[model samples]
Target: MKFNRTAKAHWKGGGKDGKGSLTTESGVLKESHYAFKTRFEDAVGTNPEELIGAAHAGCFTMQLSFFLVEEGFTAESLDTQARVYFEDGSIPKIELELKGKVPGMDESKFKELATKAKENCPVSKLLNADITLKTTFES
Candidate 1:
């Protein structure tokens, strides 16, 4: 199977002073505002790193759900957070933290499956940085 997704960005002026808007084909991010402050400083807007973190978290969680189903278990809840570590103008690593509640799943099994998901998720595979997973399972 194959799928294609498109996102557009528009920027004006210099790198440090320029402002931009991001739009995805799905309209989920219709003209979302972003700028140098948003990326480097604590500005109240979206940035590429934030977007990448969201995408990685979403992909890994969904992949873990599939693995859980295959293992004859269903998660009551799964919360994942992805932290992109950026340094020297590059992303050095991404950390995926997952907390999940699955009625009949063991901690070891949950960790195993989450690790597999972190390795196999499309976004995880796409990134050229070190990826790590930390899992917390609740009964």
Candidate 2:
């Protein structure tokens, strides 16, 4: 199976005075500028980086949930947060933290599943950021 996603940006003027608009092939539109703080930061909308983090966290959580269920563990809930750090002259880093309540999964097993999800998620493969994952399981 194959799928494609597209997002485009249009910018005007120089760096500090420049402004832009971002639109997804899916039809989501956003306004952006340096003063707004990101690709889309003003009354316009969220930035690409923020959207990336959101996607990563949501995808990772769903993958982990499925893996846990396949292993005969049922989770009450799973919450994941991702932090993406970008440096001008350096590679970006993404840190993922997840907390969950699994009825029958021990910490060791939970950690294993979490690691697997982090490594195997599609977003993980797409990211150039250094990815780090930390998970906590509650019984």
Candidate 3:
């Protein structure tokens, strides 16, 4: 099966003073700007890089949750933080941090599942950067 999603952005002016807006084919509109900080800062929209990180983190967490359930374990909560670092002359690096509370699951197993999720997630497959995963488990 094949599918596609569309998002559009419009920018004006130079990097520091330029501003932009993004709209998904699904109709969600956001504002962005360099002055706002990120590629699309608080000028009113979302940036592509930030959105990518969010999607990757969310997808990995959901996949991990499903894997846990399949292993006969359930989590009380799972929180993921994805940091995308863009340096002066190199590809961006994505660092994923996950913290969760799973009852009756050993830390070793949890780590295994988290690692699998990071490795197998669709977004992870699309990126060409250094991906790192750090997970913390709690009973």
Candidate 4:
């Protein structure tokens, strides 16, 4: 299966004082604002890294749920957080922390499924930075 998603951005002025708005074809981010302050400081808006982290967490959780059901386990709940770190003018690392409850599944199996999701998910595979995962399972 092949899917193509479109997102565009418009910016005015230069760094530290410029403003930008992003939009996606899905309409989930229609004219969302972002800027240097949003990226480097605690400004009132979304940044590219924040968007990426959201995407990663969402993708991984969905993938994990799919695999869990395929393996005959039901996903009671799942929560994931993706933390991105930019250092020295480049994105260096992304860390994923996952907590979940899968009825009738053991910890080892849960970890294996989470690892597989992290390794094979579309966003995780597409990223260029280092990715690490920590997971805790609830029975």
Query: Candidate 1 residues 29-127, lDDT tens each?
Result: 999999999999999899999999999999999999999999999999999999999899999999999999998989999999999999999999999
Which ranges in model 4 have alpha carbons more than 4 Å from their true place? Answer: none
Q: Provide TM-scores for the models.
A: 0.98, 0.79, 0.82, 0.96
Q: After superposition, how far is residue 17 of candidate 3 from its true place, in Å?
A: 3.3
Report lDDT (Cα) of residue 50, candidate 4: 91
| The 10-residue segment with the lowest total lDDT in model 4 | 84-93
Off by over 4 Å in 3: 31-37, 40-45
Clashing residue pairs, backbone N/CA/C < 3 A, model 3 = 30-45, 31-44, 31-45, 32-45, 33-41
Cα lDDT for residue 128, model 3? 92
TM-score, structure 2 vs. true: 0.79
Tens digit of per-residue lDDT, candidate 4, span 86-126: 89988889999999998888999999999999998999989
**Would you list the C-alpha lDDT of every candidate in the order shown?**
0.95, 0.80, 0.82, 0.94
* Residue 129, model 3: Cα distance from true site in angstroms: 0.7
Candidate 4 Cα RMSD after full superposition onto the native fold (Å): 0.9
lDDT of residue 41 for candidate 3: 41
